[model samples]
Target: MADLSDATLDELREALAAELPAQAAFDGWKPAAVDAAADALGVDRDVARLAFPGGAVDMIDAWFAQVDREMEARLPAEQLSNLKIRDRITRLLETRLDILAPDREALRRALAILAMPQNAPRAVKLGWRSADLMWRMAGDTATDFNHYTKRVTLSLVYSSTIMAFLDDESDDFADTRAFLARRIDNVMQFEKVKAKWRGAGGERPSLTRFIGRLRYPAI
Candidate 1:
């Protein structure tokens, strides 16, 4: 709503990102959507087109970036610090679903476009970026192989959850929430087993000790 008459293209892109999805919901992520968003924001149509030279994907990307920023604002560090890692991830994913709830149709259209062969690579990158941001926000500082593994695992979880969310008709998206919780539980259990396998000081654990530890882990 602020005066964007003098704003740079990048600034205009960011400012218009949040507005695009609503227009896209009705207009299907086309040039008309962009033009409507530009008009709504009092931005020049030509300048807005310049801002999204990559077309639909660019508009979708900018909208997702806005969603990420909103997620961070809704769940800042102080809010997540006191929670366990599993809880932090669940909360973050849930927050994103809430943010995208109003624009479900827009999201469906965007996902369809991203699923196309031409956009598959960009889609993967966007998924990874969101996962990485969630991990960073959750206070994860892993720099080893865990860094890559965590993001990959989370990307799968998030993408699957989004698919579930798209068709979820349960009140409050209860089904999607349940699906995400199960996915996170699977990842957490896998991490626990991997940690136990590594053992203290990275020494290999005896089979008996490993089995016993799995059966009765120390509190």
Candidate 2:
């Protein structure tokens, strides 16, 4: 909580984003939640409202962005470099779940807002952004079809895991952890099969290689 006397709206948004969720858990992402967060952060309520012009979605978006920032802060590149790719991805996702666990009620309400037909596109964008960040943080450098596929697959996995987590009552969320592990295992198996097929020179054409060739014709 720094001095907001000279802070811009975006800075105020970021400063208050982490605090809003706890209030949202009680106020359900309304003006009162913003007011509560503003009071807690010593930010003026009027200025805080200016920071989130898009209303609930804006608040949810800022909070989700804060989660991304926290995720990177918790797991820096050097810390992940020595691990296997699967382990890195698993750790990154698990870390996010842990960061979000305390604000599950707020997250549920946010998801409800994002699920509306009017908000579907924004929801998709947010999901992709998070998935992309996770992949980058896990050290993925693929620029081919793998890039798109990995993010799409991970978005699905992460969303499903969140759904499972919302209702999971097992000890330490073991059920959700098991569900995530199974999804990751399935993805790893798929990658292994794809690699084996490529190595064995199967007749199937490579879409990524074809796209690459289209981009840079034989020189």
Candidate 3:
């Protein structure tokens, strides 16, 4: 994961494309899944970046998000085959979130109680800008957009606790919610990072074989 920052964003993105398979060959970007996928790809630390403003990063994000959306709920019977690869990526992301249910039981309880909308499951919304994470990964942003999103939107379980709507639950939701918030905060502060790119969203990749040890230390 530390190696990701050293690689140019472009290089990392390329690697992600190669490994994720676009949820059945669809266009793909799922915000939560993006960085995780990049981490899993294990891109080289020294990959070069072009580092210029006006790069199509936002467009890139949109492209991948679109793919993810199209892939949502895809099934052989639901023959939406013409769906762009990008649109299909949402399902992949959703699938990953499915993987989280067990780790965060509160997440499952929250979804069960909330009766989460079928169109946008609770898990997906928790990390779905589905694209804002790049700047965070690159350590380029200045705003805490990521943190801000957690409290109000579908909160993620960064600290292994409760989150968002789950706060109302009398059982363990509050503790879980608080802990998750703490986790995200701890990670952010440890990394000394912001959610948006303050300088330029696009920067040249570091070419000097640097394995960035995640600016933030896990709590």
Per-model CA lDDT versus the true structure: 0.88, 0.87, 0.36
Q: Per-residue lDDT of 101-197 in model 1, one digit per residue for the tens? A: 9999999999999999999999999999999999999999999767877887788778878888999999999989988887787678767866976
TM-score for predicted model 3 compared with the true structure: 0.21
Tens digits of per-residue lDDT for model 3 on 144-201?
Answer: 5444433322223321232333334445344444444444444344233332333457
Q: Ranking by lDDT, best first?
A: 1, 2, 3
Which structure is stronger by lDDT: 1 or 2? 1
Error of 3 at 27 (Å): 29
Q: Model 1, stretches more than 4 Å misplaced?
A: 200-219
- Evaluate residue 12 in candidate 1 and report its C-alpha lDDT on the 0 to 100 scale: 95
Best by TM-score: 1
| 2 or 3, greater by TM-score | 2
Query: Could you give candidate 2's per-residue lDDT for residues 49-86 as a string of tens digits?
Result: 99999999999999999999999999999999999999
> Given candidate 3, what's the lDDT at residue 25?
25
Better of 1 and 3 by lDDT: 1
Residue 118 error, candidate 3, Å: 31
Model 2, position 74: C-alpha lDDT score? 98
Colliding residue pairs in candidate 1:
none
